[model samples]
Target: MTTPIHVMSEIGKLKTVLLKRPGKEVENLTPEIMERLLFDDIPHLSVIQKEHDAFAQALIDRGVEVLYLEKLSAEAIDAGNYKEKFVERILDESNLETKPVREGLKKYLLSFDTQEMVDVIMAGVRKKDVTIESNHLSDISEEEVYPFFMDPMPNLYFTRDPAAAMGDGLTINHMAFEARNRESLFMEVIMDHHPRFAGQDVSVWRDRNHTSRIEGGDELILNDKVLAIGISQRTSAKAIEDLAIELFDNNSNFEKVLAIKIPNVRAMMHLDTVFTMVDYDKFTIHPGIQKNNGEVDTYILEKGEKPGTVKITHRSDLQEILREALDVPKLTLIPCGGGDAIIAAREQWNDGSNTLAIAPGVVVTYDRNYVSNDLLRRHGIEVIEVASSELSRGRGGPRCMSMPLVREDLPAR
Candidate 1:
């Protein structure tokens, strides 16, 4: 029997992947709440969906099985016959204003079939959409003009942040922000009841129930034996320590964790935003992330002398670390925009460093980053360009958008 979750390497041939198509939620973004919701700007709904469809097609064209999170969530609840239980969980995290409002939202959500129920929750529930029965006439304040009873999950399209697929297991992340925190709840529901993953041996190494925050974008599977998780603005150091301890003490193939630290600014909010694996010997990196001599603050985490503890070793040169970890003779770090001071900063903001590797020496990247795209091609790498006008507005490229479910294992060493 094939394991439901298997991601041994980041640059392995992708067999199956998960994506969330842009929906009405994109249209729900308003200037008033955009920043708080982690959006730099609002996107045009029609164009973004068209761009997203093309992106999905690009994956399908590569013979990869694509799964939609929205479809799976709907099917999971219906298959498990747990509609009421699912709705209750969503409302529980929604922070409804009052008992009357909570009951009203529950009834309205339950009225729809599973699919629409999922969509409505994602698109957000407008204040006027539900009717609440209150004993007093002044239950809802007239001066309270805030739009939504429930906030639209505009960031749902980036499925890579809520959960990460690792060696025969995955992590249901505790997201860093409240706006994106509830996004994991949807994945939790799907994992619990979805037919494809429910009965499988997939392990949840860490779940979203903790206050220590971690995100999938910070998690990278280097090979069968080593993993790279970043200490960035979105993922905390404590979370990485805890996850490393779990892998060290548990029955897992992962033997080491490289806790590399990056700038905490939003431009480099996640590690993948500025660095990603593009091939067995090639990686895309932003020059700005380096110190005086291309050195990054890196630490190696391994099983300690004592049980259930991790041993840490300090390292700086990223190239040396990669060579030792993969046992490669030489590794090339491809610079975004060819490491130009101005070009690197500009394209890095648009996620030029975030390329999704479908196969060794081949990657899918946003076409708008022509300079970076050209650089990858010149380095003897296969670069597949996708439409990016609307997609780049979300501040993520192909790597940030995708969550690989299965990948063909690389031949031993």
Candidate 2:
């Protein structure tokens, strides 16, 4: 039986991918709550959608099949008859004023068809949308003037962070920020209830029930037997340890987990924000991720002598670590913005380093990062540039906006 998910290498030829087109959620960010919503600037909905469509078209033009998260989520709910259960789960997670508010919201949401309900839930339920008769002071009073009954998931456009497809399975993530915590629920529903994957042998390496957070932008499947996870602001070390233990116990082929530590800052919030694999032995790197001497904290995790234990080794030579992991005689680390301090900082903010590799030696990047794009071309890599003037406002690039469900396995040596 063919597995529904098959991603083993970061630079493999992408086959099927999941993407969320910019929706009303893009324009839902208000000045007062934009920061809380994890957006420094709100994108123009029309323009963002145009750019996102162009991005998807580029992928399709390359013989890649693109799927929409919203459509799949709605299908999953309807196929499994999960409308009531879905509403209940959303309400349980939503922090409302009282039971009456919850009941009102549930009823209002249930009134819609599955597709509309999914969109409404993602677009957020504004306070004015629901009417409830509650005697509770909390519900009646104006103590909290928050306009949204449920905050709009503006970051949903970044399909990468919600979940990651590894070898034969995937990890439905528990996001770092509350703003995106519920994002993975959609993927969970898809994997568990969708007709295409309901009974498939898709392994859940690590479910989203844990307290520790892990984001997909920090999870890189280097190869079938090796992975690279970042210990950054969004992904915790404990999460990586637990994932390594789970993988070691279940999957006998997985041999190593490289836990790379980077600065815990918003600019480099994820490993992909500063580092990404572009080719078999080539990678894009933001100079800001390294120290003065080009050292990076990296931990190697493998199976211990005993069951249910992981052996850990700490190393700081990132370049060497990558070379060994990939089994390459030589490695190329292409700096974003051509290693210029000022340009790197400027382009990195727009996710210049976050590139989506569609195939070996071929990647999709933001057209705005001209310096980095030019540098990549000089290194014998084919760069596909897409319109990103509006899309970059989300602080993510092509890689951040896509989640690969299937990638062609690389040829064996």
Candidate 3:
């Protein structure tokens, strides 16, 4: 088996990446369940799958290995005793304990390879009639019922937000909201106990008393020596600080840490939603936050006994500080949404700023964000657009669609 390469840089030679194709879970989102599911609207699964396939195929065409989370989960179930544990974890997290629902869950876990189980785990199992054992609850009538059922997981398709790969292992995030907690559980099992991935170190940052959500979408590995973290609505300052301590406490290769504080707005949910590296010295960014036009702040910390600290108003300014502090050459900033007032505003809302680069100057994007694509094209970057109308309906784009585990650094241009 080929050991997966460690991710040391964003603009690296393409290697292996992970993705979860949208499925029935997306179609199960109803207006009443939208908020609970962390989605603003329901997406057409068929169309979303088609779009996802296009994105995956684009990476495959470039010789990058694309691993599907569903296939991995099914394989894990077949290889270890983790299947039952995963099922029980899901049940406990979702608060489903009725007899019928419990039996249904057991059946679903046993059929991990089937579409039914996939749908149930991703889209969520519906509440059926509740029941109790005759001996256990003799006083309760059948009409009175037993435990309540739970809402289905409609946002599991956003796999990028559940777990993040850092250094030599994976970190299972404690999602900021309850709607996506099931995703974290699924990732935790895969990362910690899967036969194919057994023995790999896995970290879980869950506070029994407080929520410290840290999504992969907000974390970026610029180089082996630097990590750029985004603090936004989905990722908190406390979460970032905790992650920093974890990373710094264990690793000596990392020499600096940079935190880019994004505004807590729906438009800016993660750091990748506003910035991504395209090459050794080049990056794509949203001027609003990257330029400090919005209420965003940038901070940096160096490695030493004292561990010097610095703050700047804009990401560009911060970049300069990093270049000088880390002894790197100039950094380039490519504006997202075309850098035009009207176009930038329009595309940014549609997640134009969110992109996953397969290789230097080559990236995947939503076809809906046309203006951003055009801008990338004009700047000599290759754009492969996925038909994301259905996927975008769920409020995520290319960046949210992928979780890169390994990449090779590109030679300086």
Candidate 4:
């Protein structure tokens, strides 16, 4: 039996991946609440969908199986005969205040077929969309300013966040923000009930019901035995420790975890935002995450001599650490925007460093970051550029938008 979820390294040849195409959810963003929704600007739905299609096509051209999250959610529910249960769970988390409103909303949602219901959920329900017959003051209150009965999941297109596929398993994340917290539920349902995954032995290294927060954007599979995670705005330190303990005790191939701490700011929200592996000995790094002396806080975790514990070592030199982890004599850190402060800052904001490696020495990137793209070409990397005008508005590049499911193992370097 072939493993359904196997991601041994970041730079391996991509065999399968998961993506969420931009939908009505992008059009649901309004200027007033855009910031709270984690979007700087609203995207033109048609254009964003076109760009997203091109991204999917690029992967398809390279023989990668592209799975859509929205389609999968619907399939899982229908296959498992879980439509009512799914609707109940969704409403339970949507913060629909009153019982009347909740019941009305449930009826409204159930009216749609399974696929349409999933799409409607992603697009969100406006207060005016559902008819509520409540004379209660709370229902008729002066809350006209707020628009949604259910908030739009503007970040759903960034399929990389809700969960991460590790070696033969995955972590259904407890996302950091309320806006994205419910997104992981789709993954949970798919893994637990979908025909393709239900009977599979896909390990849930960490489930989403925990109090501690962790986002998939912060998780990185450096190699079969080494994992790099970010302690950033989205992932708490406690969560990383918890994950480390689980991996160590479960006989997982992962033996060491590098907890790299970056500034917990939105600009560089996750380690992948500022750092990502590109080739066997190459990585793209945004200079903003480093100190003046080129140092960043990093901790090395390994199985402890005592049971139920992990040994930790404080480290600062990222370059040396990478070379050692990958068993290479030398490693190269390619600075985004060619090490220019002004260009790097501007391009980094557009995700110049977040390149998705489909295979060693080959990557997919945003065409808008010309300076970074040109620099990558100069270094002998096969750089495939995709249109980014609408997609960039979401502040994610190829890496942020993709979730690799399976990759061919890299032979010993």
Per-residue accuracy of model 1 over 45-82 as CA lDDT, tens digit each: 99999999999999999999999989999998898898
Give the alpha-carbon lDDT of every model: 0.91, 0.92, 0.69, 0.92
lDDT of 4 at 109: 93
Q: What is the lDDT of candidate 2?
A: 0.92
Candidate 2: 10-residue stretch with minimal lDDT: 136-145
Q: Please, what is the TM-score per model?
A: 0.98, 0.98, 0.85, 0.98
> Roughly what TM-score does model 3 have, to 2 decimal places?
0.85
Q: What does candidate 2's lDDT look like per residue over 1-413, in tens digits?
A: 45789999998899999999988887889899989888889899999999999999999999999999999999999999999999999877777768888888999999999999999999988878887779877775643677788889989989999899999999999999999999999999999999878888889999999999999999999999999999999999999999999999996357899999999999999999999999999999999988888889999999988878999999998999999999999998999999898999999999999999999999999999999999999999999999998899888899999999999999998
Off by over 4 Å in 4: 140-143
lDDT of 3 by residue, 94-113 (tens): 76535655665576555654
Ranking 1 against 2 by lDDT, winner:
2
User: Which residue pairs of candidate 2 clash?
Assistant: none
Q: What residue runs in model 3 are displaced by over 4 Å at the alpha carbon?
A: 97-118, 129-148, 200-210, 290-296, 304-316, 322-328, 411-413
lDDT for each residue of candidate 4 in 222-300, tens digit (9 for 90 to 100) = 9999999999999999999999999999999999999999998998888888998899889999999888887889999
Model 1 worst lDDT run, 10 consecutive residues = 136-145
